[model samples]
Structures are given as C-alpha cells and as structure tokens.
Target: MQIRDLPYADPGRPDVRSGPRFLYWLGRNQLGGQLRSLFWGVVHSGSVALFPLAVGMGVAAVVDRSGARLAAAGGLLLLLGALTALGDTMLHRTAVTNWITAAARVQQLLARKTAELGSALTRRVAAGEVVAVSTGDVEKIGWFVEALSRFVAAAFTTLVVCVALLVYQPALGAVVAAGVPLMALAVLPLLPPATKRADEQREKAGRATELASDTVAGLRVLRGIGGEELFLSRYRSASQEVRRAAVRSARMWALIAAVQVVLPGLLMIAVVWYGALLARDGRIGVGELVTVYGVVTFLLFPLRQFEEIAMAYSFSRPSAQRAAKVLALRRTAVPADDVEAVAGDLKGDLYDPATGLLARSGELTAVVVGDPDAAGRLADRLGGHAAEGAGDSPSVLLGGVALDEVPLDVARTAVLVQDKDPVLLSGTLTELLDVPSSGAVTADAALTAARCDDVLASLAQASPDGSGDPLRTRITERGRSLSGGQRQRLTLARSLVTDPEVLVLDEPTSAVDSHTEARVADGVRALRAGRTTVVFSSSPLLLDRADRVVFLREGTVAAVGAHEDLVRSNPVYRAVVTRQTDEEPDKELVESGKSEPIGESA
Candidate 1:
C-alpha cells in the first residue's frame, strides 16, 4: 500500500497469538506490498552482485585488445549502473511504504482495542506502557516488517553469488564462501547476550519514562507535600540505571559490528593471498583473480544485512509481544447477536448480581462504600464492565434486559459511567462541552447542573482583561492548567451534556469544597429529577441530597435509607460518613452546625 492511501480503509483483525505470529500476520496482510518490495530488493542485490563480473569482463577485453568486446562490456556496465539506481530507488520507496502502512495498521488495531475495552484498558495496562507501545514500539515493529524483505533478497543474492563464485573459480570461491558463513554464524552466539542487554536497557528506559510521566502528572501534588526533591532523586536514580543499561547494550552491538568488519576483511585478504598463488602458478589469469577479489569484496555489503536483520528482530520481538498482549484483551461477556431484542426487555431497574446493588428507575440513588477498591469494583459491575476473572459473571440487568448482552453502542448510549478520576480532554471550554447533546441538556444547563459557573469565571479571569468569554478559554492537555476540582466539574459538565438515560457518577464531588459540593448536589437533584442517576459518594452533602442512599459494607448492601436516617440509626454508617465513634449522636454539632455534619470543607 502507498503512503498516500494511509490509514487503511479497514485495518483487518490481527492474529495476536504470539510476537512472531503477529509479525507473520502483518506480512500476510500486506502480501502484495511485501512481494513488490522483495522484487525490488532482488533487483538491487542482483545488480550489485553482477558488478564484479562486468568489471572483470571489461578488464579481460582490454587485455585482449578487442574493440568490439570492450564496447560490449562498457554497455553492460552502463545497464548494470542504471539497474542499480532504479532498483535502489524502488526498494527504498517500497520499504518506506511498508513501514508507514504497518505502523498505521498497528495504530488502528490499538485504537479499536481501546474503544472496545474503554477504561478497562487502562486498568489492564499501564498508561505509560500503552503510550510506549503506540509511539516508539510501533515504529520498531514496523522497522522489522520493512527490513524482512530486504534481508530475504540480500541473503538469496549472497547464496547465488557464492554458487557463481564456486563455479567460476573453485579455489578462491571455496575460501570466500567458507569465510562468509563463518562471519555470519560467529555473531549468533553473542546475540543472546546482546539481546538480553537490549531487553534490560528497554526495561530501564520504560521505568524511567513511567517515573517521569507520573512525576509530571503529580507535580502539583508533589509540591504541595514538599516531596519534590525526594521524587527528583528517585527519577535521577532511574535515569542513571537506564543510562548504564544503554551503555552496556551499545558495547555489545559495537563488538558485533567489529566482528562483521574484521571477518569480511580477513576473507578478502584470504582470497587475495590464495589468488596470488594461483596466478603465480599460471592457473588463473590476472583479470580472473581481480574478479574473484572484487566479488568477495562486494559480497561483504549484502552479508552485513544478517547483522541488521538480527538486531531488528531482537528489538522488535518484545515490542510486538507487548502490543499483542494489549490487543488480546477482550470484554468479558460476549455480546448477543440480537442486541435490539435483548435491550427491548430492559426497562425497569439496574441490577448487579455480583454485588447485590440495585438502582430503582428514575431515582437519584447514592451508594456509600467504605472500601474504595470495592466501590470501584461495584461501579464496574453496575456499568457492566468486563470483570477481570469473572467472564461468566451474571450480566447487569437494565430494565429487564442484560446490560452486557446489549450492543456496545446501545449500552454506552443508555448508561454513562463517569469514573472517580474523569479526564478532561484539551480543548476550549465550548468545544469541551460540545459533546453529543441530547437536546434535553444544553451546554449551559449541564454546566449549571455541574456547578461550573465558578470554574468558568476563574477561566475568564485567567484570560486577557479578565473579560474574555469563558467558553472561548482554552484548556491545557488533560486540563492540567485547572485545579483538580475544576477539571472534575468540567468533566461532569461534559458527561451531563450527553444526557444518557442512566448516569453513574463515582465520587463526583470528592475534590470540591463542601459548599460547592452542596450546590452541585442540589443542582444535580433539581436537574435530574425524573432521570435515573446513581452516585457513589460518602460525603453527607451529596448523600443527603439523594432520594435514597444505599450503604455498602463488605461488598454487600448493609443498609438502605435516607442519609440522616442512616447516620442516626446505623453505627457503622455513622462512623463511615462522620468518622466519629458510635457513641450518642453529636446533637450539638449535628443540629447547631451545618458544615460539620455535612462534610469537610476541603
């Protein structure tokens, strides 16, 4: 495929059984492109191999003082030169095409998998690892794909040249052929160590990259805790480890290069030394001896491809394996063929059989769980997330239909699960809120429901003259320019604008002030009065505003009541929400002060 037709119309499903299998699958997918590359590679290497023959013929013609034969040799040299340039040009074009196309195909596969897995992708794979695979790893994989054809053609040319030399002059050919194989095989034993060093280097580099990414992402938090120097020292140590590993790997590769050069030079010397004796004995002509020397010297160029192919495979194999591992991740439940039929029955309640969590339709239900990890798992199950080890877990029911059995598109449209740490993509405020608006929820309405007026005002003040429209204000990557509360509110606004039938929010106001949380809770209740919304929060302000609060203990529902009722009745619920001992109620604090019983201000 040409680079111009990039981003293939359809990057076909890949075979991701193993690294080598994935590489082979890539080759098979682009068979036509690979064949074209092979053809050009053959032409290029063949022309290079024939160069010594043409020079020898010309020398012989000159020695014989034959004008016609000399002219014929000169014409042959020009043809070979033209072929050499053409073949080299075409091979380069084809190889680059293969590189770009292969990278694009892998990129498409990654994108598809990410969409299929959604947030679970990040849970299964490290964000840094995903970033590495999508960027540098993909290029390395493409490098191997592009190099394969050239290596094949070069190896074939080397064999053909060896056979030709043996037929033309056995004594010199035997010596050169034996030395060439020795040169290629000599590096094999060293390859394992070289590969091991390379793996270590890559691992250390990845760790360093991950550390840097985390440090940058949490720079504000680090500064807040006065731990910047500690993290900096740790990163410095990681960077040094990466550096040492890279130096060791480089030394190994350099040794291999030294071997490649030294072996070929020795072979050339052997041919010349042996050919001189043959010439002295009058068994070979000067022109033929020159030809044998030239052939062996030219053969060195193609022989070097062995080293390149080996190195390429060594680096790319692990990258391919990493990519394959990511691609192999599939959602737990197999979606039914008739999604419409399955969804038709789903209309009453959302049920999670795994955790015994249920949300009544058109009600604002709040779930307060003591354990954050269990809370997260409950959220996943409620949203029909592919459970890691429970592929056979009963499907979450929405209405009467199984949520997992519904088509992915329909399920997403029906239920929107906003994680505790929601991400706000880089864009202007207007662009950020301009999602698939369901007409019932406008940008302004959603922003209001999310209590983002203060956030917008802050953005407006950050702009020129403190008069710029907040909608026009630009947000930095992942909204790093904004505070955590501001980013969370903006993400909430975006999700609200989608106006899905069911909205599941996990700790939506954990980062906001109690006053702001109170406003958000009230706004959400007023706006989603007739809609089904499930919020996972322990904050009393949010829970008090919910129509019903479900208290979860030990991964199961322990109590269900109004926030005030639960706080006064259940000691466990009171301890969780108020963080107080289960003694008599704090009547003075609960009745006299709104802020204390409601939640922490910050």
Candidate 2:
C-alpha cells in the first residue's frame, strides 16, 4: 500500500498478543509495497543461487580446454554477477524502508492516543512502560512489518533454488529439496517455548523501566524526607527481580539458538552424505553439486530470519499492549459539550456539592474547608478539571450550570484556579505570563495587584534568559531557581493577566509573609472589582478582604457571613482565626479568638 493508505488503526488493536498477529496487521497495512518487495527479493535470491553456477561453469569450461568460449561465458557470468548484486541491494533497501515506514505508522497512532489521554495516561500506564514502547517496541513493530516480505521471498527463493537444481540435475536437486525442509522444521518444535520466554523477558523489562521512572520523579521528595535510602533499596530489589526474569528468558532463547545451530548441522550432514553418493555414481556433475551446496548455504541465512521475527515479536507484543492501554484512556474529566460561548460574564455563584459551599459572584468569598483532602478535590472539581457526579466530586456552577457540563476550553476561559502549588514554566517573564487566553495585560495593574513588583525588580536585575529584562528573561524549569514566594507571586500575576470572569485562589498567599499577603489580598480584591473571586485560606489578613466568609464543618458550610460577623457567631470560625483550641478556656477562645493556632502551626 502507499504511505497515504496506511490508515489510522486503533492504537489498542493489539491484544495479549503474540508477535505474528501484530506483523500480520502491519503487513496488511502496507501490503502493496511489501508484495512488490517480496517479488524483487525472490528475483534477487534466484540470481544469488545461479551466480555460483556461473563460477563453476567457467572453471569447468577451462578444465575442458574450451578457453575462448569459456572466456566469453566468463564475461556473461561477470555481467550476471553485477546484476545480481544490484538486485540484492534494491531488495535490502526496500525491505529496510518498509520496516521504518511500518514503525512510523504505529508511532503516529501511539502519539494520537497519547494526546487523547493527556495527564490521565500516567495513571493507567507506567512512565517507563511508555518509554519502553517508544524505544524498543516501535522497532519491533517495524521488524514484523518488514520481515513479512522477506519471509515470503525467502520461502519462494528456497523453492526456486530447489526447482533450478532439479532441472539442472535431479540427484543433487533431490538432496537440497529434502534437506531444506529438515532445516526449517527443526526450529518449529522449539518455537513455542522460545517465544514464551521472550515474552516473559519483555514484560519484566517493562516493569523495570516503570520502576526506574517513578523512583526518579520522586527522588527529590524522597531525599527531603530522609527516605532516599529506603526508596533506593526498593528500586534495587525491583532491578534484581527484573534481572532474574531476564536471565530465565535469556536461557530459553539460548536453547532456541542451540536448536537453530544443531538442526542446520544435521541438514548439512545429510546433504553431504547424499551428494557423495551422487558424485560417485556419476549421476550429478561436480559443478552441479557445488552449486547446490552454495544455494543451501545461502538459504540458511534467510531461514534464520524466522528466528529473528519470533524474537522481535516477543519484544514487541508487550510493548503494543502498553501502548494500547494508553490509547484506551479518555480524559473523562473534561465535558463533551460543544459550548456556544465561553462566557460574556460569569453569572450567579460557584457552588460545590462535595463541600456544600457557595461562592457568590461580585463578592470576595473565603472558603475555610475543614477537610484538606475534600478541599483539594473540590478545588479540582470547581475548575472542571475532574468529573463530578452527584457528590462523587465537588461541583462548581455558574448561573446554576454545572461546570462539568461546559466545554473544556470554555470552562478554562471562565474560571481560573490558582492551585496552592502552581507550576512556573521556563521562559521570559512576559512569556511565562502568556498562558492560554492571557495576553498583554496592563502588566503594571496585574503586578500591582499580585504585589509582584519586587519579583519584576529582581528579574530586571538579572534576567535568566539573558535579556536582563523582566519581560524577556526566561525562568528555569519549575521555577526551581526562584524562591517559593517569587514563584507564587509570578503565577498570581499570570492568573491576573487572564482576567477570567471568576478567579479561584487556593492558598495563593501561603508562601509570603503576612504583611505582603495582606497587601496582595487588597490588590486582588481591587483589581477583581465587579468580578467573582474566591480565596481558600485561613489567614485573617486574607479573610478580612472577603465580602463574605464561609466556615466549613465536616464538608458543609457551618456559617456564612462577613468575616467579623462569623468570628462572633461561629466558635469554629473564631477558633480558626484566633488559633485557639478546645483545650484553651472557652472564654479566652471566644474573647479575642487570637488564641487560635499561630502561623504555620496549623
């Protein structure tokens, strides 16, 4: 088939597959090209078998004292030899191209599936498995695709040589025809076990790859908690387990190799023994026997490809399964709706069923969630980044329209949630703030609102991207080179630039000091005038900025009122603000409520 005809097959096409099926489909994908290559390969194989005869013929003609005629025959033999070489080159080139194309097609399918899955992919498949599929399995898929034509060509080549010998001299021909079957059949019995072990080895390798990826991604956190050595030990154990599985697999393949060697040796013995009888009986010419021997010798190499194809299948099958699993993943969190408009303006309030909290529009609301886990889930749900059914997940609504029902891009454009720990990409200060749907804001207004004028000054001092200009300088990966507060302020500035209809701030001021956080709260409230803003924080400074503050008990709103009103009426709200506990006297807790937990003490 033409490259254009390599239709997009489902990435999940392969099952707990054997390698042959994968190649079968791969060959099916490019049948036209492969069929042509197979025809050419056969022609080349036939030429290869005949070229040996030209040498023997020239030698015999010289021995028979027909030098002039033999010399002319010699020129003809040389020309045939050159043509044979050219055919072999074309056959090999086409076969390799077929392999690469097949691999590329599978890779394209895998990429499409990955895009469809997004972040949900890692949850379903190990990172290492994904890596292994891309690295090793892809090549194997190609091998199977490219091997089909060669296998076909090789089979016919064996047959063609067998017929040529029979026509040239029956005695020698019979020996080759009979012996070649023995060589091929010998490996058949050993195949089942060989393939099984190869598959086992491949699986163990994939697991090992997954383990390594997990260990690396969390290495920093493990070190921070003094668990680095423990994780290292676990990874070492995993590595050893993979090693053992690999060794067992290697043993099985080695046994197959032994069969491969022994079977061909016996075939050679049978052929030589029969040929000796033919030569002594004068039933076959010495040159005819020599050519037959040469053909069989060449045939052995292609037969070995059968072993290679089996091995390639063993490696590729597991890889295809891993890729298939990734392709099967759907970003279920995003809604399927085709939104007509993102939002001219965010209407009504944001309500989360999981937490029974309502964030009213045109108001600064503080949600003091008692359950941190519930709060995080509610945050994800509120942003329409996770699925919500009933109370399975939290829900955020705009004008009573469930956030989950809105199109992803529409939801994103409407509600911008700044998570507690936000990611800062590497780029110029201007580029970093250039997240989707955000553009040149009155940078001064956003900066003044996020209280990031200091960060801008720092960038101006020494730009990481070499511009020494805050708008042009690039940050390092994860903003690792920046301080915690600097990164938080930068992310806030980016969010402010988007100027979404509703802004969700989850502990946006956690990294900064109280005075700076207080300033930021005022700036945000002022900048978000006439817009919806929800801040999740217990800081009295941030709470004071809210037009309404809701105290959460268990997972429901215990009280909803102004910050000062809630403090007077709700004991939980008072205790949280004053950092007081039940262990403290109720009178003291109720009085100032400043007895509540101190900064970072919660």
Off by over 4 Å in 2: 1-47, 59-63, 68-116, 146-149, 163-175, 178-182, 332-411, 414-417, 438-442, 461-482, 501-504, 529-538, 547-602
Relative to the true structure, how large is the alpha-carbon lDDT of every model?
A: 0.84, 0.72
- Please give the range of 10 consecutive residues that has the lowest summed lDDT in model 1: 593-602
lDDT, candidate 2, at 351? 80
Give the true-structure RMSD of model 1. 5.7
TM-score of each: 0.84, 0.77
What's every prediction's RMSD, in angstroms? 5.7, 6.2
Q: How many backbone clashes does candidate 2 have?
A: 13
Instruction: Please report the candidate that would top TM-score against the real structure.
Output: 1
Tell me the tens digit of each residue's lDDT in model 2 across 535-561.
888888999889888777666666777
Q: Which candidate's lDDT is highest?
A: 1
- What is the overall TM-score of model 2 with all chains considered together? 0.77
